[model samples]
Target: MTEKEWNGDFDPMADPEEQKTLLSVLDSLRSYRRLAHFNSTHVRRQAFYSLPSQHWTLLSQPPFSVLDSLSKLDDLIDSNAELAEAIFLEGFKAFMAPSLDSEWVASIVPEKYAHDEYQIYSIVMDHLNVQTTQGDMDKARSCVNQFYREWSAEGNMERGKCYEPIINALYTEFTARSQDILDLDKSDLKVLVPGAGLGRLVFDVCRAGYTVEGNEFSYHEIMASSLVLNHTDKAGQFNIAPFALGCSNHLSRADQFRTYSIPDVHPRSLLESEGTEEKVPPYERMSMATGDFCVIYSQPSYKGAFDVVATVFFIDTAPNIIRYVEAVRNCLKPNGLWINLGPLLWHHASRIQCSGDENEENNDDLKYHGHIDAGVGDPGSVELTDEEVVALVKHFGFEIERHEPGSVETGYISNRKSMLQNTYRASFWIARKK
Candidate 1:
């Protein structure tokens, strides 16, 4: 057992007196190693420092300083252990505390963002984890549906509140860059926003006079974005030209209103009659579309077709980076542009797999360890190094245009203190097709 000693200035290899002090310090560190339960290898390392006169001069400083530093490190570990225990105890109390009054539910959520019906229902389901009755399930569903409706309405009302600043920043950056490559005033452009969460950026592009449509996979996200788009002042700014809004079910149904009569564009899918059967109306199909941009590479669509594609916080979430890049390539035309922003941190493999079997233990050993809401569905996550990411994009035949830090504030959000620990940092890049 080595116990570390704190000698103000004990040199390892010096006069006989200094050697004695260094030996004593090494002995103390050895003792502390045993007391602190450090591994046997650490104890051996400390014991090596105890040897007299041989490797004394090799040490960077007085051996006593190293010993003292080790002692302080031990103290830090102990303090961290205590803090973790306290946090665990507090979490247990919060989890097992007595049920609150049902009326207090409203107070639990902030008034501004309180209408998350599904979230509230999820909380209720979590509270009642045991097998539930049909009635209870139905009630939960109703509560969640109502919450969703209210949340949608609330988001519509506050569409431009906090989101506007971020969107405006993105728009300003993108518009300025676009002007450099294309004639913004003269060129007729079409824009597509994939994974268009909230669609705020889509609205911004539309307002800039480009024909734009948002493509989102999630029903909830699309609905939320639609609500915001419908209610925001910029709704009218959308390119209402007949060629902008493609032939789709929504547009066809909207055609009853004279104001909604748009120019006829090719339907994404066509219906065929089977052996003299009645002809069916064409149905809308979702596929990546492309259009010309003076500076087209920013958009991810068929090569040589689009001027630019804007992707924010998107690529890092794909489980298969290679496949994701391929998809981007398929969407962009030759000489098209791809613009991106957000953290470049690779997501954990579990998140990308969508296996739902991920637990805290599994996450502990991950390269990018972080906590998420317990019941949030498996989020597709991935993390890649800058070189790897660039390689993947290059493999798809795109050349890097510009890569730099984004201006957005990101990382763990805390009311007390912000922790900007970046295993992987954020980057903004504009790539162009060869």
Candidate 2:
């Protein structure tokens, strides 16, 4: 494809529908551009440049066409920018891919997605000879770090967009179905939201009139969530730029960045009541904790401490799913309600070594620090289906009170452009300890 055709086809300005998704994809791929620039300049510099003297030649090349083979991708992009979404989608899938095992690339592709992606990105960079400006690199680094912090279930357009949807689901279960499912009312409830990313659900649960404590293992998430929980007073406004760019088919929103806001979680008691004199802040009893879920639950103080365990977007995070079942079984008081949500997407089930047990001996502690890793005994572990999970919980002395399996629309980063809605089936259930 000619440069003009490529430019026109990939431009995000012309199409309004395509602008949002494209810009979001571009925002996600910013770190990659920076990484490619870094790789070109520092590691394997010779591979990216024809010769040191030819650096000027590389600099003179068009930004998008820096690589000769780029035309092939450009042609594909020109043919259909929507189809070209995969170019950035697959390339950075690991960074922003949905955590659902059913939607996992390994289920579709025979090989590990990350392994293949690393090579594909490397080759693309070699062809592009991209040079990342120091300022741009710094911004890229910041963006990358933020994405890493919000990796699992934050920053993504759907997650941000679906925040209300998720809350709606929980609200339904907590209120409409409370008596039928958990055999309890929602008032004065003590909730423990394990694997609470960004503490959204935790705060929401509190707003729903429950005393909540969110337990998280990731330091980045804990810090990010704490900033909102502690720093921001009730009803206060706070903004965080989780992504750097929002490039689209046209460059219209290509440079458009997104800022995810901390939702206003007012203390329930703060609302003015008719003939009421006293008002209490809603989050007065809410708190956040940082520690391994299994370890924390296994602790003497935590065992049988919580009245409810809302493992939303969690449970599948364990290398051994049985451990989570056991942890929930241990921590929850007798007949305590366990409202489990989200798909049975095993975090360890992915083709990549994203997360694992850190308790393993001689396992590279550093490797599992930022990203989840399948510890020494991990890697190649099989994920259990929802049915299996239900049976396992039953074996662990819990009776399933409710089971509703359904699909939900979700996507990483933003989807302002494409009307494409990525959906995954999730197992929603409430199990009670016998």
Scored by lDDT, the top model is: 2
Superposition error at 183 for model 1 (Å): 7.3
TM-score of each: 0.38, 0.53
Candidate lDDT values, in order: 0.39, 0.50
Per-model RMSD to reference: 26.6, 17.8
> Candidate 2: where is the Cα deviation over 4 Å?
1-187, 233-281, 350-362, 365-381, 412-416, 419-421
For model 1, the run of ten residues with the poorest summed lDDT: 1-10
| Regions more than 4 Å wrong, model 1 | 1-187, 231-305, 345-348, 351-382, 405-408, 411-425
Q: What lDDT is reached at residue 391 by model 1?
A: 72
What would the TM-score be for candidate 2 when compared with the true structure? 0.53
True-vs-predicted CA distance for residue 314, candidate 2, Å: 0.8
Candidate 1 lDDT tens digits, 290-364: 111111223343444445567766666555466556556666667667777666545445443233566543432
lDDT of 2 by residue, 205-261 (tens): 665555677776543344345444444454424343333222234232233233334
